[model samples]
Target chain A: MPKPERIDPTDARLLLALTEHPRATTVALAEQSGLSRNTVQARLASLDGGAKLRSFERRVDPTALGYPLTAFVTTQVTQRRLDQVAEALAAVPEVLQVHGLSGETDLLVHVVATDADDLYRVAGQILGIPGVERTNTALVMRQLVDYRLTPLLRRAAEQ
Target chain B: MPKPERIDPTDARLLLALTEHPRATTVALAEQSGLSRNTVQARLASLDGGAKLRSFERRVDPTALGYPLTAFVTTQVTQRRLDQVAEALAAVPEVLQVHGLSGETDLLVHVVATDADDLYRVAGQILGIPGVERTNTALVMRQLVDYRLTPLLRRAAEQ
Candidate 1:
């Protein structure tokens, strides 16, 4: 991770506005955030150029793309071949997110598939990786709260 | 979930272009997708209105907002009080995502905080939720692969 980039209240307001209306024009954002159009534009440019904001692609829903099933697989891997295991896991298209974790689990993998049968194949592919000792897979039945940051942005803006 | 909306090859290409250049203008998207400007506009509108595409807010990094620590908590809950548990978990600002899961665990919560001590408090708050039986928390040491969708988008376009 890079050094934490400090965002002022103005920037937080801009981000919060964008969170509500992502495709809003500069004029609209200015109106919503109560910031000058020029200020909004400059802040957006800085946030985008500085790598503080991620690309829009990260928001794409796999379920919308036909992969409705989501699962988390915790894998224990052979320590010596960790790098190889990570590389292999990266090659699997169904694997959306992978994290090296502290404690009993070596890796936590987030996966999505079109259906249950496809998920079986995807999990098998993950286990087939040479360094993977074993995997405990849990199917996500329902997402009560999807990934969100609106509350944080609101608090930041208020401060 | 709504009926899965079918996206044609053109839509896939348009999404792929957006994945690579999220801030690209309509003209740029039209050029990259090899579609007419009007077609690009229509496709984008359809995707957005249908809720197939997510807003840029989903891409915001909690770490960038001063919450550097990431942890996954698997919570076991009493079956009948699932809704109450979900509601309580949603009240926690640090809890980014909560998913009802199959198998032994009843819920999977993704959380973020400023530091280890903050994470401790967040976990305790989760445990404090009524009907939450027990929670197994694991701190994410390193994100080998963050959430992504380009690979799937590219494959969909190719097909």
Candidate 2:
């Protein structure tokens, strides 16, 4: 894991501005955050290159690519072949993410499918993977709150 | 829900190319995808306007903002006050996502915290929310397979 970088109020304020205006130029960000253009430029450079930013792939909604249905699969795998299991899961196109967790379940697998049949097929495929012992599928009925960081950004700015 | 737009092999190929080179210009995209500049421009405009893409905020890592610990809270809520529960969850900055799911749990809350104590506090806050019956949290130990779509895109292109 990369070292956690502390975000100061100024950085948070600038990030909040950028969230509101994703395509904003350095000058605009500076104006919005009440900082100099150079500071904004430097901060942005650091942010872009650092672990601060994740892949742009997150911006691409799977629904657009035809996989609309979303589900979480709690997977239990053999301890010895955990790495191999992860590799196999990655080979499955429907599996979007797999996070090892603490508790009854070993891994939380985020998946998307085109339909019920597709979802069933994907689940079965996951089950068939070597070292994968047990699996539990939970279909997402509605997204109560879409993934967001604006509120956190606001809090950071205040701090 | 908006109508699901069908994506052809050409569109998939273009999107795959864009994923690899997010900073690629329309002309560059055209060259890579073997399509005309005008076609690439038109497609990009449509993609930007359509439901194909999500918010740019997804590119920002919560870890970078000081909340490194990730957990999923399976919340059981009173059915009638689902909307209110969702509203309250949205108000909490740490609650990054809440998905209403089928099965025993009604909502799956994705959250991030600064540390164990922070996580406990956030979890307690969620449980304290009115209409929330019970809450179960599974802390993310490791991200085995980070969220991805390149394989899915490759499959789409093949189709």
Candidate 3:
């Protein structure tokens, strides 16, 4: 397997600038990061080329799209059919993320729904998947802290 | 309390266009979505004003930052000090997302670490929070599906 790409200090600083101002133009990034416009442009190209800077869809909010309820479903899947189970789960738009875990729970699925009734349907769909054995769902009552990456970027830049 | 801003079908089309081509320029979005450049620009402005289009930072991967290990930590906090516990947890850089759930668990913390040893340290710090009572953590062995919103956007656009 190929080695993972490493981000250097300057690249980290650029990422930090982007984290703070995602819509900043190359000139703006140059001004904010105290780097030349050419450097900012080149670094951005490198990051995008290496697939470090992911697509813009990551920034879209499910709540804004009318699916506000988020839930975590931990499921036990038949070991032999893990791949099939993942494929089936991926086909469900409500299932936002799926992780294979290290314990009794074989899969941890993060799902969102427009409401409780919709959540029930999504969960049922997951349970209906051939390889999914059992599932336990926990609804998110509130979001205390939204997902973030600034702290890590700041630390990397500092280092 | 202010009502949450609602996105119209036209706005949904623009968002779908952006999801398909995250790095697309406003001109590109206009052409792809079959909207005028002025309309695309205005819709973009409204989405930004409503705070519906989140910052691009969410696209950055912690694993790419060398924190390859990911874990979910469920904590039971002292009811009276729930806010205080949240504040403390927010102070930890490795804690990426925290959600207040509707069941026995009070908070579900999504965290990333440099490795298993680092994850241990991060979890220990979380457990050491003043109002934190009990904790259960599950390490992510593999990511079967990444976070995504394209399918939902496609559905919304089509509708």
- Which model scores highest in DockQ? 3
Q: TM-score for the second chain in candidate 2?
A: 0.93
State, as a TM-score between 0 and 1, how close model 3 is to the true structure: 0.95
Q: Which stretches of candidate 3 lie over 4 Å from their true place?
A: none
How high is the lDDT of residue A92 in model 1? 91
Model 2 segments more than 4 A misplaced: A1-4, A25-30
Q: Candidate 2 at B90: error in angstroms?
A: 1.2
Q: Comparing candidate 1 with candidate 3, which one achieves the higher DockQ?
A: 3
lDDT of 1: 0.85
TM-score (second chain) of model 3: 0.93
**DockQ-based class of model 1:** medium
User: Lowest summed-lDDT stretch of 10 residues in model 1 chain B?
Assistant: B1-10
**DockQ scores of the candidates:** 0.75, 0.72, 0.76
DockQ for candidate 1, C-alpha atoms: 0.75
> Please, what is the TM-score per model?
0.96, 0.90, 0.95
| Native contact fraction, candidates in order | 0.77, 0.88, 0.83
How would you encode candidate 2's per-residue C-alpha lDDT over B37-99 as one tens digit per residue?
Answer: 999888877777777778877878888788989999999999889999999999898999999
